[model samples]
Target chain A: MTSFVGPELTNPRAERVKAVRALSGRSMRQRTGRYLVEGPQAVREVVRFASVHELYVTAAAADRYSDVISDAHERGLPVHLASDEVVAAMSPDAQGLVAVANVSSATLDDVLASRPTLVAILASVRDPGNAGAVIRAADAAGADAVVLTLESVDVHNPKTIRATAGSLFHLPVVTGIALDTVTDALRAAGLAVLAADGSGAHDLDDLLDVAGPAGAGDRSAAPDLAAPTAWVFGNEAWGLPAHELELADAVVRVPIRGQAESLNLATAAAVCLYASARAQR
Target chain B: MTSFVGPELTNPRAERVKAVRALSGRSMRQRTGRYLVEGPQAVREVVRFASVHELYVTAAAADRYSDVISDAHERGLPVHLASDEVVAAMSPDAQGLVAVANVSSATLDDVLASRPTLVAILASVRDPGNAGAVIRAADAAGADAVVLTLESVDVHNPKTIRATAGSLFHLPVVTGIALDTVTDALRAAGLAVLAADGSGAHDLDDLLDVAGPAGAGDRSAAPDLAAPTAWVFGNEAWGLPAHELELADAVVRVPIRGQAESLNLATAAAVCLYASARAQR
Candidate 1:
């Protein structure tokens, strides 16, 4: 394990304050190659999921979450004590824990290699919560990985991380991949690409039938849980864009029999992912 | 159309600085009997789902969202235009729309009378997102209403409302009912008490079999979406407590075959509710 310590600052209105605030802005977060995560739960997930470059905690929270600090320290992460004001200056809802980690964005190529793929690609999921919830669901469904488009919310955003429920650390999450490229890569890998659309040509279960074990019938006696498959979820507001719809091998719906409009992005993704897992198994 | 004219404040800090900051404190939210909502989408949802007692929009936002204001007015809701600072004061993330609605916490008795006769009870869900998602799922699944234990997150919490995706307005949500009373009430209605648990004795499909339009083989063929039934979801963190589990006539699991620990609370609820709707339809 390796550790690197940065210089400490006493000023509440120091140069780093601007940088910290920059994290809230999309451009700044991307340019700086860092995204801020707040609260104990999020901080813990970051530590468990990604390698941390810096750790900050208020004296009180540091005392309260000693185990977390020690875990980070054990991983040789630099641990620092920031005055409560300092932490507050960095984030309005810091929850007394902050960490700076290297942002590792995934690509279409990376997702292709993962086995038993339970992938969720947000074509244009705008809401941070929806994007976050889908990512969380992808992680929960034990998908091989998750991928988000350029139009999707940043996976490192605090809200998205919180929605992931620490599953962010459990799997590889790729972002900024063009839908066409992902479609091609998935096809090349022999993985079926299933898109979730409210008015698709086929029901979701049909696609599950093609990709799942039992549905495959006599071709294979036992359902294979590790079958290569990817499930795509559309935008939180508009759902999958038309151009991206063409990218999917199949477009399946969750089958909303009632008058209700649609399931939330995360909920939809969960049903799709779980359905695939059930089919393959 | 009836329009509401209310207090006007110009100072951004004057309105949100206290409420936004105060919202972080559970005690303050409890004391005020009001919670904050941000952004146009959520504000729109509030007007549609929950009673919008007071709506505050910036002059620019009011001009931009005049139709929304008119819509709210048509519903007899009061919409107020304030300085950006005033809106900002109440919600740091005001994003052009913000509101403080009178919190209405319903009891199980109020929600039980709906025509659909299908209801959901959350035993001990803690995450506001999970709680809200379930409410939204219940709305989508055509469940007449939703009831939760006191231990669940406050439905009025902004996070919960946002999770509901505006379904909160159309659905009757009751909270703080005891587990025993809830089970007893549902049983009295002749509704089967199906509890969703990881170790559920019966599979979800089994229940769907019994409720199906094609018939579960035991009954005459007749699909009834309006059947009297109650679907229960347990705590996100620790699932249903043992005592509450005892109240269920049948405990059913969603059947997760993946390596993922468990489906998220709201996702699990959606699966169960949708399955029920599938059977009835």
Candidate 2:
């Protein structure tokens, strides 16, 4: 049976605790090569999937999420039992459990080598929640991978991780690549790169209707949904700039039947991804 | 041309400013029957689509958003030009523009009387952002209206208003209705009620496959997406309760082809609503 290791970390102001908490900042995360995964759900996922270094939890939290502790111990990861005050000092949003994990990611070239059929690329999407939501949606839609441009929010940011709801560990997310580079590489790998924007020439529904063998006549106007495809979603505020829009093979708009100006970044991404997944199936 | 109505408001600590700031509180809003709409986008919408009580903007913001002010004036609205500090004090996130508008909504009966073809119901969804995002998606899907159960977050919450991104004024949102009443009423109005859950017996994509007249076999088990329909989305954390699920004619699950446990509330709602919207079209 796995048990708590080491003496109880009782000091809230300890240097180790401070270092762990400091991972919340980008500089600290970069210098230490580690990031914080807060809350039971995320901590469990990190322990199960990522290369986790350590874990800290209060006595009650250990009791509540016994399986998490058991799993961590099974992985030979150090599990520290800390005082409630110490855990509180670690993170207010952690719900009494947190972990220090290495900042890990898959490279674009590596992911492209696998010849992924469905991919989602986020361009300059800085909002952590929006970025994380899109990642989760992409995963749910059966996308092979998600690529975030260099300007996008950090996937390891606590808010982004939390928004992902453990889905961060479910899929391969490629980060630190430029948008143009990503489009070029994916296109070379035999995938149609489509951009989602309000000003798109084709409506998403019309494309869905003409999808698969059901579509007849001149199909040159629209990209095939059954083929390998990648969707590029712009920032939450200003949509894809004209130069970026031109990078895609074709631009498709989610049909707006009501008076809404547009759907939020995450929702629109989900719609487009699901539509493609449906057609491919 | 309509210009600033009177002397500029110069005092950030003035009673009027504090009164406006206090509108952010639920008690204050309930007492005054008004809610705060922050940012130029929302303020412009409130001025155009709702009964606005007051407009507060700095001279710079007024000049930049001259159309919002011009439209407000055209509607016989009293516009107040305030100092930067004064406007900031009124609401920090307003971006130099804010409005006070009456808290308005439609009754369930009234919405049903219009013979709506599509509707979205949020059941016990306490997250304001989730509630607002669903409303925006519903509007985008061309749903006739949105209904929030009594236990749902107040639609007038500033965070909710911000999440809607000005779509709050585009469609009628009915609040304070119970889930049972919403389901019963919508079903009676000739709309099939569907509850979205992870453990649903019917897969959403399969239903879409067999939707409309294209199916050769008996379609009695599945709810037709092309028919008038209402979708009930559960809370973000805990999905619909057993009693709530029992109210729907059919329970549908969004297919999860990846390791992602589930899609977030808003994205799932958007996918389902868009599916229905496409089928209906």
Candidate 3:
């Protein structure tokens, strides 16, 4: 691994700093085909799973998290030490570490080609935090992939990446596709598309019961959770439109057993995905 | 209902505006025994369930949400029409509406006095957003009350209130009590105290299985969810301490079904509470 024996980058206005900062914006990210992953956990994940073009760390942070730097260097990725100000200027939420990764764009065909048993399709979900949390939940549920429709929030937004808590690297995340295309592709892959909404007729628990035992052992009498399925979540404020719901095979709701009117998008996703995971297991 | 015929509050420096704005801080809230509830949803809940000292709305919002204003007026609460600038200065998140509500304080005795069937006890959970989400989840699960220990985040915090999405008013939220006191009181009330932690020995689903069917039909052999139960959640970062976990009747873990290491605090609470809600139902 080649080591840099140069002084730490102190100039916040340096071309390198400006370029890294530019990744925070949509136009620049699109033009450069690179995005920034901030904080130690996200940076480590990007280094491990994706092609990280550059790694930046504060001098003190370099000492604190030497393993990640050395690991990145071992992979022939350059590690640059920068002043805290430079790091802050690049991304205020970096917490002393950042990485510039090549935008690993995946298409509907790329994700569907894997024959995913379980997938999460988000339609017009505008909240970046909610979108990222859903991605994290899907990863935790061992979903094969996550599909964000063209109308959904940009997955490359730093807020979304941070909210994913590094799960963005655990599985394939396909974005910028039409919802109809996603539903059709999943159906073509032999997966049932279930839309999750509060107003749905079928309750999630009832659906789980119909999906048979939590384990994959008994699948003769009832539909198995092991069956390939895709869960489509809609926008936070206004859930799946009538057209979107019509595209799904079934619509399911997480029953509110109490005074609460409904569950937030992320929490609902977690419950739905975990239910499927438990059944499949 | 009394009609507010006074000139619209146009001065941002008005005493009424300053008093309402002061409620945003913890010290001011404590001193005045009042807290600010912003946005339409939360303001409506505070008006319905809690005591509102004063209601402020932009002229447009007054016309837009006449139902809430008229309802508040019907309940003998004064509604004041203010300019957009005044409402904005009071709280940027008001969305043209805000309410100054008398802080409704409840104790462990007050909560347990009601013979709560299901309770959520938060121990030292400091993040306002997480705490609020937990409260909302508890409400959705139909829990009777939420107990926040002295070390937990203040329930009166505006961020916490906003995060609750009006669930804060749907149920009694008791705060600033000792964890030991809460545990003892819950146990005395014949409620099983279950601490939720990732490192726990018992899997949550297994516990649910032992808790009998999702419905309350067969309660002879298993510990039915209809029986009184209290769930104790710990801090966000460290989770429950050994001593805190020891206070519980059982420690439960939501099994990690996939590669993601752990679920966030709010999502975990949602899953746990909903599991109980489903079982009880």
TM-score of chain A of each: 0.88, 0.97, 0.93
Clashing pairs in 1: B11-B85, B12-B85, B12-B86, B15-B89, B15-B90, B16-B89, B16-B90, B17-B89, B49-B169
Q: In candidate 3, which residue ranges exceed 4 Å CA deviation?
A: A5-7, A213-226, B213-227
Model 1 C-alpha lDDT per residue in residues B237-280, reported as the tens digit of each score: 78886788889776788764433456678888887787776555
Residue-level error in angstroms, candidate 1, position A236: 1.1
Off by over 4 Å in 2: A213-219, B213-220
In order, candidate lDDTs are 0.72, 0.91, 0.85
Candidates arranged by TM-score, highest first: 2, 3, 1
Is 1 or 2 the stronger prediction by TM-score?
A: 2
What is residue A232's positional error in candidate 3, in angstroms? Answer: 1.2
> After TM-score superposition, what is the CA distance of residue B106 in candidate 2 from its true location, in Å?
1.0
The model with the greatest DockQ is 2
For the predicted complex of model 3, DockQ is 0.68
Off by over 4 Å in 1: A1-11, A16-21, A205-227, B1-118, B123-132, B149-176, B190-229, B234-246, B249-264, B278-281
Best by lDDT: 2
What tens digits encode model 3's per-residue C-alpha lDDT throughout B108-145? 77887898888999999999988998999898878999
lDDT of 1 by residue, A175-238 (tens): 8877777777876777777788897767654444355444543422322323667777887778
Name the 10 consecutive residues with the lowest summed lDDT in model 2 chain B: B213-222
